[model samples]
Target: MASNRPAPEAPYVPNDPDFGGYDEQTWEEWNPTEESVRPVRGRHRVHKKGGGGLARSSTVLGVGVIAAVGAGGIATAQDGKPPVSISLPDLGAVADSLPEAKSLPGVGALISDDSAGSPADAVTAAAPLTAAGVSSADAEQGTTDAGEALRARIMRQAENQQHQADDAVRTAAEEAAVKKAAEEATAQQKAAEQKAEAKAAAKKKKEEEARKAKAEAERLAKLAKSFAIPTSSYTLTSHFGDAGSMWSSGHHTGLDFAAPTGTPLKAVHTGTVKEAGWAGAYGYRTVLELEDGTEIWYCHQSSMNVSAGQKVSTGDVIGRVGATGNVTGPHLHMEVHTSGGANIDPLAWLQGKGLNP
Candidate 1:
C-alpha cells in the first residue's frame, strides 16, 4: 500500500462519534474553511402528536358541557325543559310565534320572575315585564266587559253600608224620643191628679164651714126670739106681789112696767094674738098664744094695736102702757101663763137667758 498509495487526503469520520473512531469534538475542534462549513438543506422531520392536544380537546369539551347545563337550568326555570342549541338567526322567528300569556285577576302585581314555570317566563324575565302601568283593558273587557259595571258594583256596596248606618241612627233617635215623651206624659198625668184631689178637698172643707155658720146663726135668732124685753124703755114700779090698801086681788099677780102713759108694749115671743079688747078693770088688754101653748097677757094698757087672730113676731108692739085696770100710776101689767093656767114669774124667765128683767 505504501509503494502505490498516494498521499492520504482525509479520514472518514462518522457524525455519530460512537459508531466510528472519530473523536467527538466541538465546532472549534473541527474547524473548516468557509466553503466546507456552509449550511446544507434537507427534508425536515414532522413532530408526533402529544398529550397536550388531548388535554386541550378535553378542556373545550368540558366548557361546552358546562354551558349546555347552564342553558338547561335557565330553560327549566322558564319552560320546564332542557336547553336546546338555537342559532341566533332563529330566535326572532320563535319569539314572534309565541302566544301572549293570559292575565289573571288580582295578579297585576306579579312579576314575570315570580312564575313557577312557563315558557313565557323566559321572554318576560329578559325584559322583566310587569303588569304595572299596563292597561288591563283587554283582559278586563274579556271578563267583565264595561268599566261602568265595576264602578257601579263598588258604589253600590258603599251606599248599602251608609244606608244601614243611617237606619240604625234613625231607629235609636226614634226610640229615645218616644221614651222621653212617655215619661213627660206620665209626669203630667200624676201632677194633674194631685191637683184635682187638692181642689176637691178644699171644696169639701169650705162647704162644711158654711154649713156650720148657718146653723149657728139660726140658733142665735131662736134664742133672741124666746126671751126678748117687752119694751125698750121702762121702770119697775110695783112688785109682782104687793100688800097695800089699793089692791084688787089682795096681792099683785103680775109684774108692772111703768112708763109714760103711751109707752109701747112689745110681744115677748113669736105668737098669734088671741084678744085685743077691753075688759072690766083690765082696760085695753092684749093676749098672745105661742106655738108651744103658752100665753102672754098685756093688761092695763092705754091702747091696743093688734086685733084678734093676728100673727105677731117677737118685738112687735101690741099695746101701750097706761094707768088702767088697778094700777096706781101709768104702768103696764104683763103676765105669762102655762097651758094649765099656772102663772110664772116673767122676771125669773128673762134672767135665765142672761138678760136683766
Candidate 2:
C-alpha cells in the first residue's frame, strides 16, 4: 500500500586510507547460515522487486547506480582515489522532482535527443573526468567551442561577401576605365580626322587661288598686247609726287609726257569718255571712266578727239599732248584715280594691269 511516510535512506561508506583497512574477515569468510551470524532488528533492507511499484523504483535506482559507477570510475582513475559508494534517489516517489536540462538558445540546440540514437548524438556526450572532477566549466567550454565554430563560419561568410563586393567594384572600375579610354580614343580620332580635313581644305584652296592667279596673268598678258602707250616718242619730264612748287598740293599729281604740239593722245584702257571739256589751269582736258569706275584724266590737251559719252577701246586717240596747264614746256599731264577717288601710284597701278608704264 502507498504510504505518506518517507522512504528509508540507504547507507553508503567511503573508502579512506587514513582509516583501518577493509575487513576481509567480514567478507565471504562470514557464514550467514551459521549460528554466529544474526539479523539486526528494525533495520530497513533493500530487496529486488520483480513486479509492482517497488519494481519501478528498483529499475530507476539501477539506472542511477550505473551512472554513478561510470562517473565515479572515471573520476577515481583520473584522481587516483578510492571508489565512492553513492545512495540512489527514490525514483518511484519523486521521479519528476529531478531538474530538467537547460533550454537556452545555443545550449539547448546542442542537446542531442538520446532516444534517437543518431550519430550526431555522440557529440553531445559528457566530457572526460578531470582531477578536479566534472564541472560546469567543461560544458561551458563545449558551448564556447560551438559558438566559436559558428562565429568562424559567419566570419568566413562575411569575408567571402566582402571579397565578392571588392571584386565587383574592381571589375566596374576596370570597365569604366576601358570605356573612358575608348571614348577618349574615339574623340582623338575624330579630332585628327577633322584636323586632316581642315588641312586638306586649306591646301586645296591655296592651290586653287594660285591657279586662278596664273590664269589671270595669262589673260592679262593677252589683253596687254592690244594696249598702246599714249603719245609715243615723248620725253618723261616729271613723275607723280615730285616735290616741287610747280604743283598746288606741294606735290606733282600727274605724269608729264613732254612732246611737240598736237601730239595724238590715246586712252590707256577701254572706257567711256565721261568729260571732254575741263576749266581752270588745264587748257583742254578729257576724263575717261573705265568699266570698273576708275577715272583716267588727260590734262594739258591742245585738242580733244572724243566727245562726252563716247565709247573708246584701249589705245584709241582721245586727245593731244600740249603745254597748257601751267606747264614749263609742252607736255601732257595725266592722272589716275581709283573707283573711290583715291589716288595711288600710277606706275604700280599700271604694272598690276600687266603694263610696263
Candidate 3:
C-alpha cells in the first residue's frame, strides 16, 4: 500500500548573479570563427535583456562552468562543506587567443549554431547584420559595368554582320567575273571555228580552179597535135576585107599566101575533098568540106593531090601554089566559109580554133 506524502525540498541555485561578466564593448571586440557556437540556454540566460538573449558572451562562459561541474550537486544555506575541485579556464588568456573580428561600420558579427548551413542562412534564422551606409557611387558603378558589357556584345555582333556582308559581296563579284570569263572563252572558241571553216572553203576553191586550169591545158595540148597550117614558105599578099579592084567582088574575100609554083598546100583540118576540077573565075580550085559542115577552098592552085570524094587529114598535101586563073600573082588563095555560107576574117577565125594567127 502507498501513503500520500509531500516531496522533499531540493537545493537552491541563484539564477541571476550580480557579476557583470561582459558589456557591449566585449561583444564588439569578440572574434568569431567557423568553429564558434552560440551559447546554450542553460547558464547563458542570466544577462539576457528582454527578448534578446546573451548580452555578453563572458556571462555565458562564466556560469556555464558552474552548471556543468555542479550538475550532480546543489547548494543549501544549512550546509557548509568544501566544494568539489573543479577548474575553470582563465578568461583573459582565452580572450587573448582569439583573433580580432573586423566588421563593417554599423554591422556586427552574429553568433550562430553550428548546425546552420551558411552564415546567410544563419542570419535569416537569427539576427541580420546591419550595415551603416550604402553608397550611391557603388550602385552606379555596377550599372555602368553592365552597360559596358552589353555595348561590347552589340559591337561584336555588328562587326560580324559587316564581315558577312563583305564576304557576300566579294563572292558575288567573283561569280560574275567567272561567268564573264566563260562567256568570252565560248565566243573565242566559236570565232576560231568559223575562221577555220572559212580557211577550208578558200582552200577548196583554189584547188578547184587549179584542177580546171590543168584540164584546159591538157585539152589544148592534145588539140594542137592534130591541127596544122595551110602552107609554109609563103608571103602574105592579101587579107580578108581589103578593099581592092583586083578582087572579083571588089573586096578581097579570101587570105592570099604567095609562093613559088608547085609549093605544097596542106589541109588545115581533117576533111573530105568536095570539088577538084577547074572553075570559071578561079581555076584549079579544090573545095574541102569538114566534119562540122564548114567549107574550105584552095584557089589559084597549079595542081591538086586530093581529088573529089577523097579523105584528107590535117597536114596532107591537098594542092600546090601556082599562077592560076584570076590571080594577081603566083599564089595560093584560101577562102573559109561556114555551113551557112557566111565568110569571115580568116585570121580572126583561125584564132577561134585555138590557133595563134
Query: What are the lDDT figures for the candidates, one per model?
Result: 0.62, 0.65, 0.66
Top lDDT prediction, candidate number: 3
Write down the TM-score of every candidate. 0.37, 0.47, 0.44
Candidate 1 Cα lDDT to native: 0.62
lDDT tens string, model 2, 142-177? 533545545655787999999999999999999999
Clashing pairs in 3: none
Ranking of all candidate structures by their TM-score, best first: 2, 3, 1
User: Candidate 3 residues 1-357, lDDT tens each?
Assistant: 211122223423334242233221111112222233233333222233345333356555644444443432433212453343333333343334444222323222344333436665433333223312223343344422445545655787999999999999999999999999999999999999999999999999999999997887677667766766788898888899999888768999988888899999998889999999798778899999999989988998998887899999988998898887987679988899999999977777665565654
In order of lDDT, best first, we have 3, 2, 1
In candidate 3, how many Å is residue 163 off? Answer: 5.4
The count of backbone overlaps in candidate 1 is 0
Number of the top candidate by TM-score?
2
* Total clashing pairs in model 2: 0
Question: Global CA lDDT of candidate 3, please?
Answer: 0.66
59 in model 2: Cα distance from truth in Å?
4.3
Better of 1 and 3 by TM-score: 3
Better of 1 and 2 by lDDT: 2
